[model samples]
Target: MSWLALFFLGTFTGLLAGIFGLGGGFLLVPLLSALGIPVAEAAGTSLIAVWFSAIAGSSLNWLKDKFDGGKSFQIAFLGIPAAQLGVVVSNLFPDRLLKLIFAVLLLGMIYLMNLRQQLSEQETDIKLAPSPPTPGATGRKFYWWRYASIGAVSGFMSGLFGIGGGLIMVPLQLGFLAETLESAVANSLGAMVAIAASGLIGHAWRSEVLWIPGLCLGAGSIFGAPLGSYILPRLPNGLVTTAFRLLLLILSIYMVRASWASGWV
Candidate 1:
């Protein structure tokens, strides 16, 4: 792809990433593959792009006091190592298989997001209704396992698929941690910085990255990430959730067809 084309692609990807706390890799890898880049190479390139976008978005989150430092660190601690292992495992798969895997993952994510939305709605309704106060059942207990599990799973997917892991992280935070959507998004972006960096190192060591393309994409993301962050807080919670699910639905359909195309493979 031309530098200009890559630049524009990165900008669009970054915009969405900023809004949704994604690393943009979920979209980037498949889109690059569609543009005729090899799947493995696309995945590797996406890590670089994700790294930049995460840094950009995370920085803004921090500046805006939207970050949860302790929680983010807990996720990154396990995520960093898990990401390296993921890269090793990815080398065992052929591009055709990887494409199919990615498609399936997208479909699964759509279901998960939908489930999260429903759960969020239920939680909202429960909060709105009056309830008897419980004396000793404070919901503020910290759970290390929760963060560790989130990190490991998200990190592994990041390495395997070249995504920022926000797809997994945000939903899990909301479901298990009772984080608001905006807070979950901010925390997800924060954790992605280290996770994406670790994945990028592994991909680079394998010589799978296209540096020029990745750099151009990264540069564009730096410009777009802030704009996305700005818009997220202004949007309604339901609208944001709906948009996320819809986007995933569309992408999943496109990925299924692309992965099944024998000629493409």
Candidate 2:
């Protein structure tokens, strides 16, 4: 029954991830908890599942020319090391404290999403012009540092929360790198592949992953990713964004309440 539940959850999560280019850990963590797994265990298992799902989804996108391999690699290089550091830090925190922190982070994320939506609604549309050709040594250094910094932060979040870091990466890319939302989403997934991979390695070394459940979820996600990618491009961006934000808000509230009830607050 637990395996079946994991399979279904993974399918659903993968669909959302493929469509939105998310890490899918948001769905996995709650589903695992509902299945009676310990919170930290659930997080660790979900990270593994998310890594496979990201790979599958990214592959699908790559076939469609939606992925940027160079950008992805640059981000991954920095993010993987940062994720390792995050795992070390996570090990130092108590489980209850971690859960409380996760709850708080989720709430903050919900608020940020709302703020972004409101601000975007009020903003005038500005057309983006073509980026000027990079000039010699100056351009390369600037972009290298920028990409590395983004990767490190994203990686750290992945390690701390066992997430793929799309929730953080997408916004950062859009806001700081001035990338298009679609591009950011795609690129974020690419970066997540590396972050998740590194995190999984750390978790494995720490004996934190549950292989059976993770594999079950990954199996279902493999099928779901292509389906989500197929449906995503046809949907309206505003509608999709609204739906995602609402879902996150509901989940955040639920998680907060759950943490409180568990005396982790």
List model 2 lDDT by residue over 5-53, tens digit each.
Answer: 8788788888887776566787777666666666666767888877887
- Model 1: residues with Cα > 4 Å off, grouped in runs: 19-21, 126-142, 229-246, 262-265
Per-residue lDDT value at 2 in model 1: 91
TM-score to native of every candidate shown: 0.85, 0.84
Give the alpha-carbon lDDT of every model: 0.81, 0.75
Candidate 1 residue pairs in clash (backbone atoms < 3 Å): none
In angstroms, give how far residue 135 of model 1 lies from its true place: 13
Please give the lDDT score for candidate 1. Answer: 0.81
Strongest candidate by TM-score? 1
Candidate 2 wrong stretches, greater than 4 Å: 111-124, 128-137, 233-239
Clashes of 2: 0
